[model samples]
Target chain A: MKISARNKLDGEIEAVDLGAVMASIKIKVEDPGVLTALITKESAEGLGLKKGDKVSAIIKSTEIIVGKE
Target chain B: MKISARNKLDGEIEAVDLGAVMASIKIKVEDPGVLTALITKESAEGLGLKKGDKVSAIIKSTEIIVGKE
Candidate 1:
């Protein structure tokens, strides 16, 4: 899919926790970190996401506040 | 700052484009991908964010739809 957002991290599925209305997906990207995504239960099932699957964390937000200290 | 979101990509500021009310911040992660963040101009200035500065791309969404094929 063509997305305007430029960040695309290559990672593997680490965990999948599905709730009634929401689901949390943990993607283990390189650099020794994990990217967690929260989505709807329906969407999670639709994607057939599971542990050891490869997926991209598609993040498109207009409120990505930048910080410096 | 304490956020519920678990995805925090550590990166360095690659670019900062400021407009009247909004600003676009680009961050280069270690995995050879760039993360783009769109925030308010006020927030951008308030954080004193600029190129070469290190910041985390904080993504917290309740609708991070996952896709697989």
Candidate 2:
């Protein structure tokens, strides 16, 4: 899909934590950092997410605060 | 700061485009992905963000729908 957002990380699923209404999916990208994505439990189940699965962690936010110190 | 959201990407600022009330910040992370952030123009100014600045692209969304094909 052609998303307006430019950040698209091709990553491998490392872990999937599902809660009652929310789910957290950890993806291991090419870098050393692990990207965590929070989505609805229903969507997570619908996606059939599992470890070793390849997915794209697409992030599109309007409130990405830029911080510097 | 300890944010509830888990996805934190350490990146360097590549470009900053400010509009009337909103702004777009492009950041280059360690991986081969360029993260784009959209924030308020006031907040962007408050952050004093500029090119070559190091920042963290924090993404917190409760509706991060997971997609698969």
Candidate 3:
């Protein structure tokens, strides 16, 4: 299925750390190294996310912050 | 300020499209092709963003989604 989010990074799961409410996922991508994603524990479990699984990190343009330094 | 967001892509502003309520910013990064950011029109005006300006795209892990196909 097609998604609206512009940033779709394909990578393999490096690790998964589940917390009480949230779950942290580490994805290893070739272009940008490691990308971290945090989602609800329920959502994580629903997707059956695990280490070494191939997945894509999807981010919308609105969620991204433009920082000037 | 040190942000907890792990994905920070430093890039130059390529374009800016301002709407009545929101604004779309296009940033060109070296590693990735281009990153798009959507922010409120007020925030865009407050930041005085313009083309050729150097900036970083900041995104929190929670705002990202993981998809498998």
Best prediction by DockQ: 3
Using TM-score, rank the candidates from best to worst: 1, 2, 3
Selected candidate, larger DockQ, 1 vs 3: 3
| Rank ordering of all candidates by lDDT, starting from the highest | 3, 1, 2
- TM-score for candidate 3 (chain B): 0.87
Q: In terms of docking quality, how is candidate 3 classified? A: medium
- Cα error of candidate 2 at position A6, Å: 3.3
Model 3 agreement with the true structure over B17-63: per-residue lDDT tens digits: 99999999999876557879999989888999999999988889889
- Tens digits of per-residue lDDT for model 2, B22-54: 888898888756777888888889889899998
What is the lDDT of every predicted structure here?
0.77, 0.77, 0.87
Which structure is stronger by lDDT: 2 or 3?
3
Per-residue alpha-carbon lDDT of model 3 for A1-69, expressed as tens digits? Answer: 677787766789999999999999998876567889999999889999999999988889989999997
TM-score of each: 0.88, 0.85, 0.83
Candidate 2 lDDT, A1-69, residue by residue in tens: 677754677888899999999888888878646877788888888889999998877766564555666
Ten consecutive residues with minimal summed lDDT in candidate 1 chain B?
A: B60-69
In model 1, pairs of residues that clash are none
Report the C-alpha lDDT of model 1 over A25-61, residue by residue, as the tens digit.
Answer: 8888899388777888788788888999988776675
List candidate 3 stretches off by more than 4 Å: none
